[model samples]
Target: MDFSLFAEEYFDEVLRLLRHLCTIPAPSGEEDERVRFCQEYLAELGIEATLDPAKNLLWTLGAPSQRVTLFMAHTDTVFPRATPLKLADDGTFLRCPGVGDDTANLAVMLACVRCIVEKKLPLHRTLLFAADSCEEGLGNLKGCRQIFADWGDRIDRSISLDCSYRGVYCRSVGSHRYQITAETEGGHSYFAFGNKSAILPLAEITCQIYEIEPPVVGNSKTTYNVGILSGGTSVNTIPQSATMLAEYRSDHRECLAEMETRFAQIFSRAKEACPRLTVERVGDRPCMGEVDPRALDELSHRAAGLIQKYTGICPEFRSGSTDCNIPHSLGIPAIAFGLYDGGGFHTTEEWLRKDSLKPGFCIGLEMILREGEAE
Candidate 1:
């Protein structure tokens, strides 16, 4: 599949879109700029793009049908709005904060849709394209959650454009994120040394969480961490409240359940030290429940075949916590594959192959054209 002609025509257009999107500073919940830009851009091409309450922009191609193949690329990056957006293009690579992760993929999706609409290409199934929001950090798949809420029953399959060039995430790694707080009366540090201290209880609970033995089920593994911890107002003041942000993840449903139980027990025990202890479950990305083996295999096989076709790489089938988590939880067949080659995801110095956009467009366009039925 030679996409040189298509790339020649649309590469600059796609690059322009990617640059504009990168500069807009779309960080998870704050994706209004990107949402508006994508909506207006697609609508200008005569595509009816809809912006849902969750900041997800969606449009459908092909005739109306029950069998829909949804293509999703999130519009948000892990970097905060304060992070300066810088690009270093040296002919072969586009180096920037989020030029690769989902930004490049979103640009590719936009270009693909424009090509199809301009050429009036016909497809076998309804192709739903979404530039979704809130896929990183605490956003917790809010965009895909709304997407599935509105169109879950209608979608037969899904392909989320994410990751790198040589992989397909067939299994969903479910996770539970929590924000735990301990509160107690505070006094002068010297005077309240013997009184109930909020920091002590929070620290104890965090240590207990780290002490739990990680469960391993076949290829599935359970892991947990406390990423953020803070509380006291001053060094000399006994902390009135202490808070910690923590999460546990696993690829199996039973492991998640077990971790949930363990978390509850840890929080419960902290009440003895700090009577005003509180726990909040902030995010819950699910693992697969009961999916048909045939459907899973078919979805993975098709995505892997296309990847192998264009990139000449035998794509690895793996597990991840991504936008695909939403559909996999709802029993919808979904596979997440990459649109370009890149590294340093979730960091300030991310980069992507500039030339890979051509083949990526070809791979994505074909996947959309021959979706549900036989290729």
Candidate 2:
């Protein structure tokens, strides 16, 4: 298929839309502004978009049918509400908080809708374009959960355009995140000498947990990390409390369960070693697994081929999580593709490659065309 034609025709509009999207500050749960922008933009393209109670923006095209295909991108960015989303001096890159992490993806979804409407592509299955909210941290995957609860059975497939800069993600690398807190009675460091310190026990527990071997096999990678840690009140005093946040990722559910079991053992050992210590698991995010690798391979290969045709770079497997996890866990066919090259995703130095926007638009257009032909 000749995707360049659409790119050539809509290049200016695509750039404009991307720039506009980068200006909106839609941090995770607070996606009201971004949602409004998408609803209005979709409306301009003659597509009816709706916002759910969770502030997820959904734009529907074609009639609802059994073989419905949902195209999803998150409207929420990783930046906080106060961060300024300003384009930089360099013309090639746009720098801002959350520019590439998701705003670029949102822009690509919008451009796809415009292409579909302008080109009048005949889609056999209903196309549902969604700008999901609350994909980061404590927001959880509420937006996607809502979609699954409402339309999962009728939907045949899902294409999630999330924060990828490399290749396509066909296999679901499931992850479980937990917040652990250890506490003890406060005391003076010198007076409480030889007494168990909460910080020391927490550190020892973390080391023991990391020492446990992961059970994942084959090409799939299984890993664990302690991302955050905090404890201790003063340099001269015995710390009364300590807390650590950790996450484990693997392609196999059993492997994750095994790791969880091992973690419990380690915690119990830590508690036994330090009678004052207490451990608690405060958060959990399920791991995603592919239902059919062959089917996913077929879709990914075709999508990668189209992306390479336009951008001269084939898509790569991304290890990060997204709303695709929801469908992938449920055995639904799904893939998370990137719309642009984004860097420093959750930090102040975040930037979006402007040059990639047009190519991304073409890639998404081609994906939609291909979806219409799926048997």
Candidate 3:
């Protein structure tokens, strides 16, 4: 395909929409505004999009069928509502807090849907487009979980547009996130010199948790991290309570289990020592261990071929945790793709190449067409 000639019609429009979307503050739980924007955007394109009870923006093409291909990108960002968004362009790259992660991909998805509908593209299978919400931290893939729970049996394949750059995530990494707290008697530091402080056991548990060896199975890996910690009142006092938020993820179920057991042991030991420690499992993402490698290879090869045809960039195949994670757990075939070349993800200065928009959109459209074709 002649890349430039192919994307000429939609590239500029995608750019405009991408810039506009980056300005919308949509952190995890607070994605209504962006979802509404997406609905209106699709509505203006002659598509009447609807919202599920979870507020995911959705539309369907082709008649209802038992076989469906779901193409979705999340509307939420890791950045909070109060975070300042700086949409900048020097004619080469677009910079913002979430320019690459999903926002850029969401723009490409919307543009592709518009073009496909306007062009009256042929489709044998039902093609569903969704701008889902609650994909970031602590949202627990709520939107996707709902989707699969409701429509998993009928869907044949699922795809998520996330991160940046051309690649296919072939495996799903499952995870368990938790909040652990420790409490103890409170008193002035001078008077409570021998009393057990809440922070003491919490610190010990943190160290022990970090020291545990991550399990490995074949090429799969398991790792854990303590991302947040807080406690202690004042410098002059022995704090009564403290807490830490931690998580572990792996591509193998057995490894995940081992990590969980290790986590439980650590908590149990801490509680035995301090008698005021508790651990709560707050989030869980199931791992998919039985994905057919041959099938995944076929999808990856197909995606890479289309990307090369449209964008001239070679796509890589890898594994990741995304909305796809939930479906994959249910034995549904799912993969994730990126929109452009970008770095500094989850940071304030994330960006994607300005030139990447066209190819990215083209590739996404090609995949949708190829996937929706008659078998």
TM-score of each model, paired residue for residue: 0.95, 0.90, 0.94
Question: lDDT of all the models against the reference?
Answer: 0.86, 0.77, 0.84
lDDT of 1 by residue, 5-110 (tens): 8766988988898888878899999999888999899889998898899999898888767767899999999998999998888988888898888999999889
Best-matching candidate per lDDT: 1
| Clash pairs for candidate 3 | 165-340
What's every prediction's RMSD, in angstroms?
1.8, 2.4, 1.8
> What is residue 45's positional error in candidate 2, in angstroms?
3.3
For model 1, the local distance difference test gives: 0.86
Deviation in angstroms for 235 in model 2?
A: 2.4
Error of 3 at 94 (Å): 1.4
Those runs of model 3 whose alpha carbons end farther than 4 Å from true positions after fitting are: 1-4
Give the alpha carbon lDDT tens digit for every residue of 166-205 in model 2.
Answer: 7788766667677767777768889887655778877887
lDDT at 21 for candidate 3?
A: 94
